[model samples]
Target: MKTFNVPIIYRSPLISAIKQQRKQQDKMKKDFTPTRLEFGPLTILLARHFGFCYGVENAIEIAFRTVEENEGKRIFLLSEMIHNPQVNSDLLSRGVRFLMDTSGKQLIPWESLQPEDIVIIPAFGTTLEIEARLESLGIAPLKYNTTCPFVERVWNKAEQIGGKDYTVIVHGKPKHEETRATFSHSRSHTPTIVVKDMEQTHRLAAYIREEAPAEGFYEEFKGQYSEGFDVTKHLGRVGVVNQTTMLASETQAIADYVRQAIQEHYQLPDDRIAERFADTRDTLCYATNDNQTAVTGMLNVEADLAIVVGGYNSSNTSHLVELCEEKLPTYFISSEEKLISPKELLHYDFHNHEELRSSGYLPQKENITLLLTSGASCPDAIVEAVIRKLAGFFGLEHLVDETAAAWA
Candidate 1:
């Protein structure tokens, strides 16, 4: 676990102390229990694993460092460095412009990019085509590349399975930059397709079993499948990989469903399963698994509601909100500003893609219990600010400083 020299604005002494103390106490990380921050009337059940992950930290360090190292040069990001709004805004404020949006929509034309201009490949990575396009401009895409190691690991896994003649079935959002990049890389080695969820996986299973017409697969899958992808030929052997930020369990479930389909389609024996289905569980991301499992463990305790902090459009953050919403009232917010007050809160309804204003969000009671966590891309400063805001509601904001000092 290599640490990065992330900007101080993104760090928090209080959260850092809490995390360090927890890490020291649980070296093995077997303890999934939340850290109970007792603040008289407010009991904050901070999740064991949350906030910025290794990949995000690495990206932040690289992006900011690139800015510092290249003062006079024009710098451009292929897309967002990470999903967090604060980090992206910070980069933008520093004059690091984006060439494309998250959906691969071009913001600045490729023709405008000069050979001397610096181009940064974001943490989500870019397609081989995009890489080629950058190279054509005489810009070294790899020099300022900040693609997360875990994402590259997934690509490597996809390539490995593809080399063995297995079609790569990517479990991720179809329009996601990472998935598109992965599809491009995998399709180059072998055929690849993107499945957003189990529903898509089930639809794909029909093709795998030859229960659906091959021509229909083209229309059904549409933009999801690779060019020159023959449903009949490619569906025979497959492997599952995912966008590192996607829900790990759903990816596994899709893989299991696809594997079962392949098993039954070929009527393969126990040991012969690998002949049709490639083992690709290794592609599941460590940070995604840890964050989700930590949420599961955190949910074991009874809390009034959960507050998830992160970018509204963040895939990883949305999944965390989804997990929390299943168990209790969960409010998805980008930062502490969404807290509004004790009685009223503004949160994002990710499913609907809109913000909702809610009253009586904090229960009317003497003592309040809350489960708090953030997405992998969220800054600790944001989480600490959230805690401080919640504490201010009870007039126990001083306790936060006291706790931090004690921990210090």
Candidate 2:
């Protein structure tokens, strides 16, 4: 892991307690079972890895620096700086405005942008069209751009596959900015299409097998396919790529399904199929892989409930919630504010795309355990706040220091 110079804002008493807790946890490492700490009525089991990732940190650093350096100059973001609402809200508070929303809706008119204004591209890279527009305005996109290097790496892989005359089949949410940017970059070299999940991949496979009509492709794919893309021709020799934050297993499954479809259609075996399609491994960021893997490891514990903290619309955060929900009841919350009480909590339902309240969210058992994790863009401070809130509900606020000590 690369070392990040993030500031630690631990409250004094909490810091002391965390240090003590760390000592105890370190001492009991070998024979460690589920340790119970009383915080009023809540029991929390922190995941091994959670909170802000390197790419987010790097983006925040650059965004803040740009704000400080360009005082009195207008600053615009290509999109939400990162998925966390709090982070975007903080940037907005500092006079940074977004040109586009998460779904690629243009909130600020491009015609309004000036040559002197600074535009910071989000961690998710912008489409080539947006880059060109910014350049036309004399605003160098790369000057203040904060696109993650990992995302750029995926684009590079797409280019490499495209150069080999293979169509790029991207496994990601088609509406996502990263997917759009990647698709645009890939289309410069070869035909590209985006698949959101297994269902979409299945439809794509059917199309590849000539079971689906070519005219229906536009309606099914909508805005997902590259301009001038030919469904029949593009699906013949395709390579797989993915959004850097997509579920690792899902991406692999989609790739495998596509590969199989091509083989069957061409009457080719595994060795022959390799000549047409590139076997690219997952493009998920290390933070995403580590956090999701850590959540999986945490879920081995038979917890009564799980809490996944981050912006609801956050892709990587939603994936964490999905992973946790598979094993136990999971609450996808934005902050500690969502923890209303021991019996009630507010959470976002990814399936329905709505925020709903639930009762009996926290079990009242004395030894109840919770699997706690957060999205890549979430801050540890918010996680700490959640711990405090849970402890307060259980009337174990005094144990906060002790718990902090354990972690330290």
Best by lDDT: 1
- lDDT by residue for model 1 (1-408), tens: 798999999999999999999899999989999989999988999999998988899999998999999999999999998998999999999999999999889999999989999999999888999999999989887999899999999999988989999999999998988888888888899999999999999999999999998899999899998889999899999999998888877888898999999999999997999999998875756788888889999999999999999998899999999999998999999999998888999999999999999999999998889999999999999999999999998889999999998877
Off by over 4 Å in 1: none
Whole-model Cα lDDT of every candidate shown, in order: 0.92, 0.83
Best candidate according to TM-score: 1
| Candidate 2 per-residue C-alpha lDDT over 1-408 given as tens digits, one digit per residue, 9 for 90 to 100 | 465544354123443344346446665333223334556445677765567777888898898888988999999998898898888888899899989888988899999999999999899988888889889988898898789989999999999989898999999988888898998899999989999999999999999999999899999998888888998788889989999889888988999999899898889987788777787778888888877777777777777988899988899999988898888989999999999988899999999999999999877576677878888888777877888888887677768877656655
TM-score of each: 0.99, 0.91
Per-candidate clashes, comma-separated:
0, 18
In candidate 2, position 316 carries an lDDT of 94
Error at 279, model 1, angstroms: 0.7
